[model samples]
Target: MNPIDPQHRNDWLLRAEPVEGVERIEAFFQAKAYAMHRHDTYAIGRTLAGVQSFNYRRSTTHSLPGQTMVLHPDEPHDGHAGTGEGFRYRMIYVQPALFQEVLGGRALPFIEGGVTGDPRLWAATDALLQQISQGLDPFEQGDALAELAHALAAVAGTAPARSTGDFASVRRAREYLDAQCHQAVSLESLELAVGRDRWSLSRDFRVFYGTSPYRYLTQRRLDAARAMMLRGVALAQVAASAGFTDQSHMTRHFTKTFGIAPARWLRILNGARATEILRNTAA
Candidate 1:
């Protein structure tokens, strides 16, 4: 796709290359950008210009530039431009697993109202929310995630984990699932591999990871499929390779997880890449 025309009042989204446990996007919208959808990742961001509005948690909220928006996992929400002038924003979708690592099994933070003007959060997100072209090194990213996680916990008034669950066994189970996501995995198999009862494991996994075991496994598969798609792989091939039953099965899950079809997702990504190349050439 050609680089978006600045004068055209069309919506455009630019996605950064996915980093571990995080995805970043910068976008501008003249009208509605998304339908009501939920995903199992923390949607944290800042509105850079205009009025960024969304219907979240049964109410509509508007965010102005310099405000922080924090939407918890699996929260139903839809986004659009609040005013005639439209909206522009940058966002990072962080897997709950990364926050779990920092909180060590504490409940994920909840920033009521979906947006904040908290100075701590504004500062915490600074490093990770830089220009999409200015990517962070691994160490920098880790530090930023940690800082953001702590800031969220503090803001939400959530205490650190009290060392209640079998954190070690849960970690092992998570690692096993990560490695074996491409294959059929059963509760029995997970039990044998992690040396824990299925019920206990299930309980502890949710306590530590903020999601169920099945969800974590499915997300791993989805992550693989996304990477494959980015490489211009055929959808059918990607489906089979990523452990889905078939193309339709993968497409269903992909759309449910992302709120957009796989093909449209690829187009947006390609458009972003094209825009980046054009910018580099002009520079």
Candidate 2:
């Protein structure tokens, strides 16, 4: 299959490609590339050229070449080119579940500023962040994930002891949220199911899972909506089936969560697909 080139008129090209089943993207943007949004997975990447800048953790951060940007899961952030010449980069999104598996029941590591110059981190993520196009074997992938997790923990320093958290209660709550993500879920219902009070459960969930239950549910629905939308589902039907109240409701949340409205997101994907088709035909 031929790779897609971004639209000629647009000042950016979004490469819709994945490496070893993990969503990996290569892109360049002349100016603002994203609006305020958050993802349910970790956005880990390196800036290749020019100045890469973003608002993270309530401050403006910049990444030049040879620096890694590690945005934690569910953290709100936005990106753009920091200079007139524009910026280019490659990024990989890894699900929190992968880190959870390796870290066991501990809280996910947080790398402050969303940008890091730690050599250890760069070394740990070397294989996974390679610029070449290649697939990773299962064994190699597992090893790299493990190394990356440990390196992250090391950089973040010890997290103090896991205090003020009930592992069992949080786990139960998370499981319930995952199961009923497609329906309306109330804090009262979550309390009853998890056998814990609402506020305590909420606190525990935030510490363990990194976000509020409601936000997590909204992201999950958005996740489902995105899948269906990419498969060519109509926006209205996609919103309804994904448990959103209506099309506008979904669009609002989609833009808030992903930085792009559903229609715009679809257009970008379609553009990439069309470019790929043309390239393959020419080849």
Candidate 3:
């Protein structure tokens, strides 16, 4: 079957147990059937086979074997098969909290166009993803998570000017931010909390974390909103609970980041006749 349009490609999600902080998903794509939906976790995946098409940022993107699709958290996106064979992919949803465990509060790395061939990224990711797709020892999962953190850092971070992975200062800042994610955070307060100057901590955060403090906070909010919408929350309530200013504000960023409106997410999650709505639309 020929793939359908981007607007309605994502009408379903088959969820699996979350690995580490990531929610694992194995999506069976119609020639093209996933609609736009962004998640709080970093969306990383390798297409098992077929040509997977997605509209991301402002472009229609495609992924093939050996190409790592790095969809930064909080961006809007959707997926489906662009060819007759259809597409299958496994996704690992990594939380910013886990990524922060490595890099602190810095800006998360954004690999352009949702793809990369950096050896560092490839090496760091291959194993963890493999284990999630298959089976692994519990102790091994722990070790892989730690290595994955460092590997992600190596690929995403700049060479630190000081060249030291200063632990105490960065960790303190992370602890404070995590504890206060629900509260307004300030530079001066973070400086005191981390025992480093604001600029240094912020710099290190970007270097290690792959995203900035504010963006991290927004990701957390989006993550929360995603869960709520999946459970049938009203837009106004989801906005408030997810820490947005209002429904309109949430809608703007929600569609911008996830490629679908709250109503659609709620409707889909409720299993409200989507198979029918998209039956003719499915490839």
Candidate 4:
């Protein structure tokens, strides 16, 4: 069965579930879906039905079914339906750290235009993007993540031979961010924790992890907020608990990061739940 029958629907329907550190979603949107926004992780997935359109890297791209989209970290982009019939697709948000684990200290691969038609990537990502309802085992997921990382680097062509980054220092900074996501973490704190000056550390971080330290912290906070929101927590409470200055501050960041407001994202989840319930009752 077609999971998303765009022609049969008149309005947007979106469903998302969190898996580990990844966010998996199947959504159909008519007309505009989201505004310009950026994220700190790679947004990778396939276009399932119709034409999935998005603006990336200063140009518009159309993703037909079976095509893979590999948006880079910290890149600004937006999405919409590419045709009058709308579009449906599934996507997974993957942290760059997972890729770093496989690449050692090499810079993350950059695939221009944010999408690809490579069969190697499709094969490598098969297990990671399976449509099954169950989650992946730790071992299984680790293997897939490793394979996908290699496939990405291979497909993006060869990188110039360069020295490995300051992996120890960068890893320490990442751990600090993971632990102190709820609190205001200063550059000095990271510097002290990693024994590298903030300026040099920031450059090393971007070279190795694909994003800046402050942006990484903000992304971690956003990740925390997403987890809380998925549990049906109140928006105001989620904002404060996620370390935002206020609800509005969180809302602005949330909208930009996820390409939709927190309230709207929650509504999409509810809509999906309702749709599933109706289908089950009929069955």
Q: Which candidate is the best by TM-score?
A: 4
Candidate maximizing lDDT: 1
Pick the winner on TM-score between candidates 2 and 4.
Answer: 4
lDDT of 4 by residue, 1-283 (tens): 1455634464445544555566666677777888999988988888877787889988999988777899999999999888787777777788998888778777789998888999998888788777635566768878888999999999997474348567888899999999999998787878888899988899888987788988889889998897898788998999999999999999998898888998887787777767767777999
Question: Scored by Cα lDDT, where does model 2 land?
Answer: 0.78
The CA lDDT of each predicted structure is: 0.86, 0.78, 0.66, 0.82
Report the error of model 2 at residue 77, Å: 1.9
lDDT of residue 160 for candidate 2: 45
Quality of model 4 by C-alpha lDDT: 0.82
2 or 3: which has the higher lDDT?
2
Write down the TM-score for model 1.
0.91
> How do the residues 1-283 of candidate 2 rate in per-residue lDDT, one tens digit apiece?
1212334425444544443436766666778888999977788898877788999889999998888899998888998988777777878787665676677667789998999999988998888876534656668877898898889888988374476578777777877887898888888898899999988887876766677788878977987887788788999999889998999999999998878778877787677567757877999
Total colliding residue pairs, candidate 3? 23
lDDT at residue 247 of model 1 (Cα atoms): 95
Q: Rank the candidates by TM-score, best first.
A: 4, 1, 2, 3
> How many backbone clashes does every candidate have?
0, 0, 23, 0
Clashes of 1: 0
Q: Which ten residues in a row have the lowest lDDT in candidate 1?
A: 1-10
How high is each candidate's TM-score?
0.91, 0.87, 0.64, 0.93
Task: Report the CA-based lDDT of candidate 3 relative to the real structure.
Answer: 0.66
Clash pairs for candidate 4: none
Worst 10 residues of 4 by lDDT: 1-10
Residues 1-283, candidate 3: write the lDDT tens digits: 2343455455444454454556665555555454676555578877766687888899988888777888876577887677876676667777766766555544456677887667776667776567332665556656766676666556676343344655457666767776776556778787777778777776665555545566666666776787877667877998887778888988877775656666765565445245544664785
List the candidate 4 regions with Cα displacement exceeding 4 Å.
1-17, 158-161
True lDDT of residue 122, candidate 1: 97
